[model samples]
Target: MGKPTGFMDYSRQTAEAAAPRERIKNFNEFHIPLSKEEQQIQAARCMACGVPFCQSGMELMGMTSGCPLHNLVPEWNDLVYTGNWEQAYNRLAKTNNFPEFTSRVCPALCEAACTCGHYGDAVSVKENEHGIIENAYEQGFARPKPPKVRTGKKVAVIGSGPAGLAAADQLNKRGHQVTVYEREDRIGGLLMYGIPNMKLEKHVIDRKVNIMREEGVEFITGANVGKDVKTAKLLKEYDRIILACGAKNPRDIKAPGRDAKGIYFAVDFLSATTKSLLDSDLRDNKYISAKGKKVVIIGGGDTGNDCVGTSIRHGASSVTQLEMMPKAPDQRADNNPWPQWPKVCKTDYGQEEAIALFGHDPRMYQTTVKEFLKDKNGKLCGLITVKLENRQDEKTGRMVMAEAPGSEQKLEADLVLIAAGFLGTEKYVADAFGIALNERTNVKTEPESYETNVKHVFAAGDMRRGQSLVVWAIREGREVARAVDESLMGYTNLGA
Candidate 1:
């Protein structure tokens, strides 16, 4: 450990955020990073616990407890404290394929499991990771290093999301010829469109893609493999095919008037805005505008929060988010003790901006839309909502939501954005490849082995595991790459 007593000497300090009111005017990251010295001090706070749960990546009580990548937290923290930033970056890159993406967007499971956090604030693992990667980029430590020798084995990776990218990066490094095919016009499946530019600017994705291209990974955008490009052709040409296609089919509400205009899926709404912003700086009205319109967002999750923030930026007249579930506690409950991922209320950036602008939190807990109201011309006008109460099911013995009597209310809404979470992978792509799907609709594969029922066909990330975090997707990619490598050569030196 760099400083044995560093935790006792310094209290926890996090990065500063831009004022909500000021930050909502533009779509850019608002976090103000700590200076080099301050970041070093923060790293020194890592206690170097004898049993560091921060890197365990264990599943406890049905929730992940630490970094899924099993990042070398204490080792890198020591490196940062000793001013060995190059070594710190090396250690970080050893496990994590994309710290920039994870540090900016991950829920920070490692911090939640930190020993210090059991009694006090945990070390800023995410921020320190961000510092290391950004510093490495600035110092030219992130330069492309193509393989010295080519093994002449060709591989094809479908989907250009984090998982696909990670798999391609690994496979290419193993001296194999690799090509990545993306359905969208741009690379980065969800990162390019599903996420707003405010959280992660598009330029960051482009920077990494450029480096991968330089390192000999072929990327083909607008190449929808199963549709325009025939699946038979891919199977005929490539020695191995990895399906990293994400679960993007959004779960839709079954409320009346769902077919009305002025209602859209959250991904479509966000993607339209980002595309418009990039193409013409929003000068063209290609996106669904919420300007001066009452907006209602279904599903009070991260996507709904992003809708709230984006609506505010679009000059929405009013905004409200509906949550069917009860609000989480402000602090950890007794049962959810230390080292467990705390199920507590989180005020994300979008929620903060909404509160600042609207003078109140926009979430409506234990409420769901009963019916969508529409105007005569078939445009969405409002919705009827009803409160719900948790009741135990007699057969299942599990709590389920039931509507509370006499709790129905109507609210006006000019636009409705469905931010409900995804169900699983779309059927068309799975059907195209003749891949078997699980009961959950995700692509079925053997446990710990990414290979599907079909020979030489593999699945990973959301396609195999359903909707999950970017960090988890990266882990899936790395592991799947190892599986593919082992199958190809009968042995693999690649790390899982």
Candidate 2:
């Protein structure tokens, strides 16, 4: 625990973000971290509550309430407060494999469930975590520690996202020979491209990947399994195969003129920009150009917001975001009590940039694209959008967003980005592996197990659990690693 009365004595403070306008000029991490001393002070604010829900990864009201990795938030906070940097890092590394990735991209469900946050500000757990990890890297504490004894059990992990990386790290730590396969040219599946650089710099991923490589984990990039690499070969070569390829099937927008030239999937647009940025610093003109063009993004989730920010960085003339759901309350609703994930409106960094540049919030609530308008040459020109209202479905007994009859509107749009989310794992990957898919299209596994119907083959992460947070994927990875270790060696001591 931290100082007994530190929550009362010290106020909560976090890293300051660079102004949106200034940061829009280049794609880089914009959050300036707090000094070591300031971070220690912030860590001191973790109150010694008898029950710390901040680390309790429980679901309440059908929403996750805290860190899915079940990170030892209070313990690490106390270590940070006591200036025990190395120990803090050790405690952090116990449960979560990639604190760097979580600290940057996580929504901080831990903070939302913090006891102190019930009445006042929550402890700066995420920032404190960031400080600890970054400081560990700065010091010599985070050096590679390859296992001395090799069990000679080879594990082939398909995909190099957080889940795959975590499984590879843990299994390797347990003396299993682990090899990671990535379809993309680089490691870090979504971490490398799905997320924009302004949120998480690519170097952060590379740094940890280098550490993994040094620790005896083998990584093969540009290996597209199912299509290029044969599953039967992997089955014959490796002792076990763990499918962590992630849910790569993007849900498409179906409407008239859907084949227009100027429309692109959000993932494709983001991936191209990042690939080009890494390859030639955007000098190659390899990405979809938003420069001097009007942009409209469908699906008002994180990906949609990312599109808004990316477009702004590309000097978009104007940007608009279509959201099918109504805007959430500015503050937590009475029904949405403490400890449950707050169902409130959050203006993320992307939206902030759009507002600062456009002088207005770009989101249109309860609106959806009715049709894509294209020119004679098959180029996207504009779009027809319709307002939606919540209506009760008679047979289903559920609320549905139905179109409002007289609320159609037309807007000029030079480009459209569909961020409508994913359905599940790609069919080709599943079919090639000879694995069954659940109703949701994710890899089918028995309840509370990573074992697939196929013997010696396992599944984890988004491929098994559907599209989810990076932290959840890491948790799955760790759990699957434990399962594989236990299966390989009659009994194992790896933490889940």
Candidate 3:
């Protein structure tokens, strides 16, 4: 441990975010990171417990507890405290493929399971991680180093999200020539378009991608495998193929007046805004505009909150979010103990902006859209919502959300965005490869395996495991790379 009493000596600290109203004027990262000196103080707060649950990546109560990557949290935190940032970056890179992305987007599951947090505030592990990576970049320690030898094996990675990128990075490091194919015009799948710019700037992705290119990982954008590119060609050309195409099918709301105009999927709406912002800074007016409209978003997940924030930035008159589940408690319940994923209410950036602008929270818990209201022109004018209550099923004896009678209400909504989440992998990609899918629609694979039923083909990430966090996707990528390597060379020494 860097300091035996460090946890007691220093309180928890993190990067500061801009005021909600002030930051809504533009789409840019708002967090002001702590200085190196200040970060060292925060890093010292890590107790480096004898049993470091912060890195355990285990499951508890049907939710992930710590970091899915199983990051060497204590080792790097000590390095940061001792003024060894280069070594900290090295230790971080040993497990996590992209600290830059996760440091910003991850929910800090490590902190949730931190020993210090059992009573007091958790050590700022995520900020320490961010500092190490950003400092590494400034010092040129993150430069690419191509492999010295070639195994003469070829691999094709479909999708360029975290999973595909991690897989390609690992395989390329193992001296295999790897090429990544992205269906979109850009490399990042969800990271590029699905996620808004304010949370993670695009230049960060480009920086890492450029380094991977220098390390001999070829990326082909606008190449939709299984559609534009033939599956047979890939099967014949490459020694193995890894499918990292994420879960692309968005779950839709089935309700009355579903065909009304001005309603769009959450990903489609977010992607349009990002593409337009990147292509011309919104000057071309080629994207969906929420300006001067009363927006209603379905689903109270991260995507929905992102829509709320994006709409506020676009000058929306008002915004509302509907969540079918009951509101989580402000504090952890007796059944919810330390080291488990905390089920609590969290007001994200978008809702914070809404509160600052509208003088109230935008979410309506235990509420769901019952029907869409349209005018004579077939444009979405409003929505009817109904309240829900928890009820126990007689057959299954499980709790379920059931509609409460006499609770329907209508609200003005010029634009509607569905952020209800995703179903599974798209049919075309699975059909083109002729791989079998499980009941959940994910590519079928044996438990604890990444290989598919088809020979010389494997699956990973959301394509293999449905909708999930980016950290989990990266782990799946690392594991899939190891599997592919073993198939290619009979044995493997690659890390998962």
Candidate 4:
């Protein structure tokens, strides 16, 4: 691993960011990087603990615990600690295809499980990871290392999200001709649009895609299967097919005034915002202006945080985020323990900015939006909310919420973004292909095998599982590649 005393030698450090005030003026990535010299010191902080849990990727207490891609965290950390970044990059690429993407957007389950983090702060595993990948690219080590031999097998990867791209990367690296089909105009699904530029700039996606293209993976955008393209055609032409289309069916609010014009789904808002930003800049008095409007965001997940950050940059007159659940404890609760994703409350960048700008955090817990109020033109005007008390239902024997009487309140909101989360992949393509679906409506496929009921067809990632982090999608892609390779060659060395 790393130097035995390296963790003690260097106090944990991470890359800083552009001043919020300065960076908020534009929708671009804000996090700044440590210099190469500074980066080396940061990487050396890895304790390289004996039973490294960084790559365990276990699911405990309904949350994932480490890198799902099963990256050689300690190996790479040791390599970076010794200033041997070239070897570190090679080791990293053995599993992950797009470290640059995950390094930025991933919640960093690996850091939460870090051995050094049993007490105080965890080593900056995330930032150090970004450092290594970024350095590898800068040093020209990221050039395409295409497969030496083509196996003459063809694979079609549906969806251009992280999972699909990862599967395509692994399949192509095994010398299988891989063509990725995306329904959107761009190759990346959520990475290209669903996320805001400040969190992950599109240029970062373009950077890695360029390398993948040179590595012999083909990307075809704006081709929707079961519509303009036929699923049967792909099933006939390709030796194997993978569904990485993603879980896109957004959950909706069924309360009164749901049809208000200004009330939009979080995915729609985020995707539209990113698309508009890329189109030119969705600001100014003429754009989809959140400027000077009172915005209310529903849901308290990462998507909600993104909306909060984006709204702040748009100069919203005021912002309030609502969470139905009670506020999480500042420290891990009795039920939550070590080696688990802590269910604790900490201010993310958005909340931090809101606090810095306003006097306090713009979040309210144990409150639910009852209805949206609108004006004559049908544009949203405000919302009615009420406090709720946790209660147990005698019939169902399950806990539910009951509104606390006389605790209702009204809040002005011209824009309301619902970030409640997704259900599963939209059924359009699945039905068209006649693929079996699980009760949850995710594409039905055997775990690890990824094979659907249809022969020669497979599924992976969000489309097969459910909406999850980019790291999980990457892992699915890697696993499914091995599955498809095994089906084709009757054997596979592609690690699942």
Top lDDT hit? 3
Off by over 4 Å in 4: 283-287
In model 1, the clashing pairs are none
Q: Give the per-residue lDDT digits (tens) of candidate 1, residues 1-496.
A: 7589999999898899999999988998888999889999999999889998999999999999999999999999999999999999999999988888898888899999999999989999999999999999999999999999998888999999999999999999899999999998899999889889988888989998999999999999999878898999999999999999999999999988888888899999999999899898899999989999999999888899999999999999999999999989999999999899999998888889888999999999999999999989998889999999999988999999999999999999989999999999988888999999999999998777899998999999999999999989999999999999998989998877
Candidate 3 structure, TM-score to reference: 0.99
Across 1-496, the per-residue lDDT of candidate 2 in tens digits comes to 7888899999999889999999999999999999999999999999857888998899998899988888999999999999999999999999999999999999999999999999999999999999999999999788899999999899999999999999999999999999999999999999998999998999999999999999999999999999899999999999999999999789998899899989999999999999999999999999998999999999899999999999999999999999999999998899999999999998888899999999999999999989999999999999999999999988999999999999999999989999999999998988998899999999999999999999889999999999999999999999999999999999989998
- Ordered by lDDT, highest first, the candidates read 3, 2, 1, 4
- lDDT accuracy of residue 114 in candidate 2: 96
For 1-496, candidate 4 gives per-residue lDDT tens digits of 6778777888887778777667778887888888877877777778777787888999897888988888889888878878999999999888788989889999999999988887767877888789889999899888889899999999999999999999999999899999999998877899998888888899899888888999899999889998989988998899999989999998888889999988888888788788778776764233355788899999889999988888988899888999888889999877898789888996888887787777789899999888889999998999899998999988999999889899899999999989999999889889878889999989998765699998888999999989889998889989899999999999998876
Q: For candidate 3, what is the lDDT? A: 0.95
lDDT of 1: 0.93
Better lDDT candidate (1, 2): 2
lDDT of 3 by residue, 108-141 (tens): 9999999999998999999999999999999999
Task: Output the better candidate (2/3) by lDDT.
Answer: 3
Count the clashes in each prediction.
0, 0, 0, 0
**Per-candidate TM-score against the hidden true structure:** 0.99, 0.99, 0.99, 0.97
Superposed Cα deviation of residue 484, candidate 1 (Å): 0.5
